[model samples]
Target chain A: MNSPLLDVRDLVVRYGPVTAVDRLSFTLDAGETLALNGPSGCGKSSTALAVLRLRRPDGGKVRFEGRELTNLTERELRPLRPRMQPVFQDPYGSLSPRHRIRDAVAEPLKVQGTWNRTDGPARVAELLDRVGLDPSYGDRRPHELSGGQCQRAGIARALASRPQLLVLDEPVSALDASVRAGVLNLLSDLQDDLGLGYLFICHDRAVVRHFADRVVEMRDGRAVPA
Target chain B: MSSEALLSVRDLRVAFGPVEAVRGLSFDVRAREVFALVGESGAGKSLTARALLGMVPRGATTGGRVRLRGSADLAAERGRRITLVPQDALSALSPVHPVGDQLAAAVRSVRRLSRGQARARAVAALDRVGIPDAARRARAYPHEYSGGMRQRAVIAMATVNEPDVVVADEPTTALDEERREQVLRVLAEQREAVGAALVLVTHDLEVVREHADRVLVMYAGRAAEVGPSGHVLGRPRAPYTAGLLASLPQDGPRRHRLPALPGTPPAPDALGPGCAFAPRCPLATAPCRDHEPEARTVDGRLVACHHADDLSDPLREFV
Candidate 1:
C-alpha cells in the first residue's frame, strides 16, 4: 500500500484551562476522505487548525507527506502551505469581498509565485470551469454570486495550486440544502480526479456517513475512532 | 376553504419596491400539524413566516388575506392567535433579562394574568419543553444557558400564550445534530400540547420529512409544490422538489456521484415569465419556458409544473 498523505499523531490543542482537542491521532491515504464527526465544542475544528499548523498545537506531531510540520518554522511552513489548503465553513468570509472571483482564485497561484500576471487569467478561467462555474463568473465580485457559486469559487481558489490534501471545515454547512448536494458532488468529483486526500470536519452525521470513508468521533476534545 | 385549516393564506404578495420577494403565494396549515415551507435561501420562506407573524419589514408592501380559522384580518389576531419562534435563540431571547422574565412577558401579552401567575406559567412552560431544573434555569440569564437550553427557552416563550399558530424559522440551523433532535422533539411536543398549527420555514429537507405533516415548496418566490410530506418527499411531482430530494447524500454504499441539480436557484430580480425551475429541470421542454404552469391538483397534491404530469418519482434512481 502507498504511504498516507497526512499523518497526525497524539495532537493536542488547548485554550488556557480548556483542552479543545486531546491526543487526537489519524491518518489519511491519498484520495481518501476522513471525516471528524462530533457535536459542538467537540474540538473537531481545533484539530483541523492544528493539523494545518494555522493554530499551534500544545503537543504532538502533524506530518504531511512524511514531513514533520509541527517543528517547522513560519518561513519553512509558508512554502509547504500550498500542498495542503483549507476550505472554510463560511464562503462569504473565506473569499475576499473586494476582490473579483478571478483575482481570488488566482491569489494562491500568485502567492506561491507559480504564475505571473499575464498567465493568471487563463489559469483562473480553467479552475473556474473545473469547479463548474462559468468563465463569466470570474468578472463578478464575491457578493454578486450565490452561496453555492461562492463556495465553488472558493474551491477553485483552493485548487489553484493543486493541493494534495484539503482540510474542509464544515464546507457545505452554510449553504442551502438544495445546492449543498451539488457542492458536495463537486468536491467528491474533484477528489477523484486529483487523487487528493480530505480531512473533513463536520457535525452532521448524515453528511459524514455519505462522504467519509472512515469516521472519527470527537467527544469533549478526545478522539474516539468509529 | 377547508374547515380543518387553522390558518389559510390566499394570494399573498410581499414586494420591496421594485423587487418582489414573495409573489402570489398561498397555502393552508391544519390544526396540530407541521406545515413546512421548504426552499432555497432567496425563495422567500422566511418572508412568508414574517407575513404569518405580521412582522414584514418596513418599506415592503404586503397584500393578501391571512385568515385565522374563519376570520380574514390577521392584524387583530397577530399576537394572540399567532407567535414566532425566531431563528437565533441567542438573539431572540433578550440578553439583559432572565429567561423567565422574557417568557413571563410573552405570557402577559395575550392573557390579563397577574405578575405572579405569569411567572408561574413561564416556569411550567420551560418544564414542559424538557429543560432540566426549570425553576432554576428560568431565573438564569440567557448567556448562562447552553445553546440547546436557550432554544428550549425560546420555544417556551413562543408557546406561553398558547397561540393558535406558531411560526418557527430555521429554528435548529445553529444547532448540532444531537441538539437539533432535542429542539425538534421539544417543539413537536409543545405544538401537540397546545394543539396549535406549526409553520416551519427551513432549507433542511431532512427536518421537513421527519416533522412536517404537509409541505409547500417555494422556488424563486413561487409555490413549486404543495402536498402531504409523504407524497411530496416520497413521490415528488415537481422537478425542483424531485431534484432537491435526489441530491441528498444517502447512508448506504458510497455513491459514484451524488445526483445534483446543475444550476442555482434564480434570483427574484432575475426571474422571467417561464417556470422558475425550467432552467435547471432535467425534464424541461418548450412549454416550460414560454409561460408559467398553473397549479394542477394530481393525486391530491398541487404541482405547478407543465411536465409534472409526465415526470416519475425524481428520487427513484437515488433510492
Candidate 2:
C-alpha cells in the first residue's frame, strides 16, 4: 500500500542517435486514469513501451509496486507482465485475426500461467461481458467486427488477466469520431468499476480531456504537464 | 455570386470501379470563405477534394460535373484555378528527388515558368508557410524535414501556382497543436493574398470551429448538415451531427460519460432505405426507416434529417 502502482522517473529511451524519450517522469496511483498526450514523434508511445519493457530504456528508473522493473531480465519480468499489459493502437494488429475472440481474450490468462481448462470459457465470457460485448461474440473473429467492436475485443483481451495497470497506447485514435466516444466512455466506466489504473496514450487533446484524471504532455523526449 | 464564387462543385460524382464514392454532391466556395466538408473516414471528403482537381484515379468511371464556377473547366484553366494539398504530405513528394526538384517539377508541369522561376516560386511558397530556413531546406528531400515542415512544403507547392481555390484534406493530422494553428493562420493569409476559396476536409471539430466560415457535415456518403460554421457546429440539426458533437470531450462542465452513438458508421453499400444513421439513432421511428430524409431548413441550417425540426437549441446548450 505504501508503494505507487507505477513510479517512473528520469526515464530515458533512445533510438540510435535520436533520444525518443528524454527524462520523462510520471507516477500513477491505484484506480487513476492518466493520459500521455503530445504531437507525433513526441516520444509518448516510446515512453509507454519502455514501461512494459517492450523497448529497453537507455537510462532511468521504472518501479511497479515496489519492484524494480527497469533492471529485471526477460525471465524475471515475465511473471510481472500480466499485472501490466499494453493495449496497442491497432486492435487488428494486436489481436490475431485468425483466432476467435474467445481465444484472443483467453491468451493473456494462459500466458500468465493461470489457465484452467474448465474455467477458460467462463472467464472469457465474463471478460467479453465486462467490455460491453455480447457473449455470442466469443467465437467471432477480429475482422467480422467493426472498428469499435474490434477495439472492445482488444479491451476484453487486455482485461482477461485482471491486470492492475493497463498501458493503452492510442487505443482509440484510429476509431471513427462517433465510435471513439463509445470506447472512451467504456474505458471510463470499466476503470471506475474495477479500480483499474490506465496509462492512456493519445495525440488528440479533446479525447484525452474527458478520459484522463491527469494528463502529461510529451515533447521530443521529455514529459510535461498539459 | 458569379465573381464572388471561386469554385463551385455541381453534382460531382467520383467512383472507384463500380463503387461510387461521391454521389452528386454540390457546394460553393466563395473568395474569402473557409468551406469545410467534415466527416469520418470513407465519407467522400477526400474524394470530393480530389475530384475538384480531377485527380480521381485514372479511368475510375468519374461522372457528373465539377464546374470551376465562372472559369473554364479545361485542364489548363482548372489547374491554375484549383489545387489540392494532400493529407500525407511527405509521401506525396517524390522520395527520390529533393523538395526543390519536386516543387519545380510541379510548377513546370502546368505553367510556362522556367526552372529558375519555378525555383523562386517554390522558395516563396515555403516563405509564405513560415518555414524558418526556406532556401536551405529547398535542397533537402521530403525525408529530411519533420512531419509539420514537410506538410508545409507540400502546401507551398500547391500555393506556388497562386491558384484560385485551395482544397486541403486533413492537413493538420500529422501536426502538433502549435504547428496546426500556424498552418491554419498561414492558409487564411494565403487565401487573402490570392482571394482563393479554401475548402478543407477534417475530422477534428475544434479545427472547424476556429478556421471555417461554412461547415458541411457528411455522414456515410452524403452531406448531413450544411450552414454557417457556428450554426452547423454550434447548433447542429442532424442526429448524426448531434451525435458527433456529444461524442467530443471538452474540458468544461461535468465530464459525463462521452455520449456515443450505439452502432458503427454504416458501410457505403449498406446504407438503408430511409436514413443512413437510423440504425444507431436513439430517437428513430418507423417513418425514419421508410423514407430517406430530405434536406430541410432548421434555424437557417440545411440538414438532411426528418427530425431536424425538433432540434431548436445547440447540443451543448442542453448541458
Candidate 3:
C-alpha cells in the first residue's frame, strides 16, 4: 500500500558454496510490525541481519526509506544507525554485563552525540522511566537484574537513539511466560506511542500472531508470503 | 487407564538432590492423542518426559511409577518401546556419525532388526517425517541436513521402531512458523501412523491449543492444572493458568495491553507456604497465602488454587 519503511527485493544470502537465502524479497511499512517466520536456518534471521548490513548478501537489494542500505559505507551508515537499533535473542548475550543500566542506555546517545557529556545521566534516567523501570535501576549492572529486566534495559538502549526501525531478534525467547507477555505488551505500546516499525524475529507463532501486523514465512532462503 | 494409552506416568517425581524438579506429576497419554505440557522454564515439563524413558540423569532422585499401558516390556526394551525425540536436533545427533548409522544405532538399541531392515525403516521414518530423498539423506552427516531436516532425522530415529509413545520436548522451538506447523503436523500424522501417543512439552499456548487433546499446566514442580487442552487453555480455572492465558498476544485485532501476571514464577524448591502463584496472582486472598491449596475438580480440571473461581473473567482474545 504505502511506500515501505524497509524494502528487500530478490535478495540472496549464501554461506560459502551453499545459498542460505535464494532470491528472497519482503517489505515493511513504516510504523508497522512484520514477523519473519520459518524453520530454523530458513534465512529469517539472515534476512534481518542483512537489512542492517550486519550480514553481506550475495544478491538482492535492501532499501531503507528509499535509500539503498547495501550501497552505504560504514561512515555513510553512521547517521542512519541512530534510526535503527537491535535487541537480539539472548538478552544476557546482547547486553554487556559490565555496563550499568544508565551507561548502557546512555551508550547509544553518547555515540550519536544526542546527549552531551553532562546530560547523559538525565537522558538515561528518562529512558529508564520510559521502559517502566525505576530510576534506582540505573545504578544496577546488567547481571544484577533478572532476564526480563535485562531485556527491558536492552529495549531502553534501543530507544535511546529514538530509532524509526527496531529489529528485535527473538526478543522474549529467553524470558519466562509471564515475563514474555509483559515484554510483548511493552513493545506494542511503544510502537503505538512512537510510530515505530518493527522487524520482529521469532520462532513462536503464538507470539507473532499476537503482535505483528503482517506475517512472512521464510523457507530455504525464499520469502514464502502468507 | 485404558489399554490404548501409550504412556502412563503415575505420580512420577524426579529430584535433583536438594531441588525437586517434578513433584509427583501423573497423566495418561492415549494412542493417536497428543498430550501437551505447557509452562515456563523450570516447571518440570522436560523432566517428566525424561522419566518416561529412564533418561533422567544418574543419581537424580526419582520416585513414583511409569507404565507403558498398551505396550509389552518397554522397560526391558527402551529404543523399541517408548522413545524421545529430543528438542535440539543438531546437538542430539552426533556430528561424526552418518545419519544412516545413527538411525541404525537407534534401531539396533531397541531390537535385533537387521542392518538392511533398519536402513529401510530409517528411510521410511524419514519419509514419514516429511523429508525427501530419505535414502540419500541417510548417508549424510548430521551437519549435512538443515535444522528442520535434522529434526526430521531425529524423528525418524525415534519412530524407526514404531514406539508406543513419542516424547517431543519443544520440538518446534527452533522452527519458524510455517516450518513449525509442518513439523507439528508431521508429528501428528506420524503418531497416527505408528499408533503412538505424542507427548509435546512446550511453553507455547498456540501449539498446545491446535495440537494437544489434553493439557497439563505445571507450576512450582506440580501440576497446577490438568484437563482437556481446550478447556484449560481457553477457560483456565487456576490463577496461574488464567494469568498465562491472559498474557498471551492475539492475532486479527490488537488489544490495549496484554494482562501480564505481575511476578516471576517461583523456583521449584523455594515454593511459598500457600500457593506458589499467590505472590504473583492479582486476585490472591488470605487463604491463598496462608496454606497451599490441593487440586480439586472444577469444570473438569484438577486445579490447585483456593481462588480458582476468580479465573472466570473472560480472557482478551485468541488469533
Order of candidate numbers by DockQ, starting with the best: 1, 2, 3
In model 2, how large is the Cα lDDT of residue B226? 86
Evaluated on chain B only, what are the TM-scores of all the candidate structures, in order? 0.96, 0.91, 0.92
Query: Per-residue alpha-carbon lDDT of model 2 for B1-319, expressed as tens digits?
Result: 4356567766678777666677667667787689999998778888777777777778666676667766565355654667887888877889989898888888888888888998988877787787778888889888888877887787788777778788888988757677788778877888787778889999888889988999989877778898899888877778788888888887765348777778787777666688878888876789899887877777887788887787574364323
The worst-scoring run of ten residues by lDDT in candidate 3 chain A lies at A217-226
Could you give candidate 2's per-residue lDDT for residues A1-226 as a string of tens digits?
Answer: 5778999999999888999999888899889988898887889988998998998889999999779898899999988888887888887888898999989998888877899999888989988998889999988899888888889999988888778999999998888878888888788888888888999998878777777888898888786655
Which portions of model 3 miss their true places by more than 4 Å? A1-47, A55-72, A112-118, A136-145, A173-177, A201-210, A213-225, B1-6, B69-75, B113-120, B127-136, B309-319
Selected candidate, larger DockQ, 1 vs 2? 1
lDDT of 3 by residue, B1-319 (tens): 5466567777889998877889878777877778898888778888888888888888798898888865565566567767888888899999999998888888777668888997787777787787788788888998888877888788878788887778898998856667787788778887788887788999888889999999999987788888999898878778778778777766546545677877677777677678777888767789989998887888887888886665564343211
Best by TM-score: 1
What's the chain B TM-score of candidate 1? 0.96
Go through the candidates in order and give each one's C-alpha lDDT. Answer: 0.88, 0.82, 0.82
Question: DockQ for each of the predicted structures, in order?
Answer: 0.74, 0.66, 0.50
Check candidate 3 and list the clashing pairs.
A21-A221, A38-B176, A39-B176, B274-B291
lDDT of 2 at B271: 68
Question: Where does model 1 exceed 4 Å of error?
Answer: B70-73, B314-319
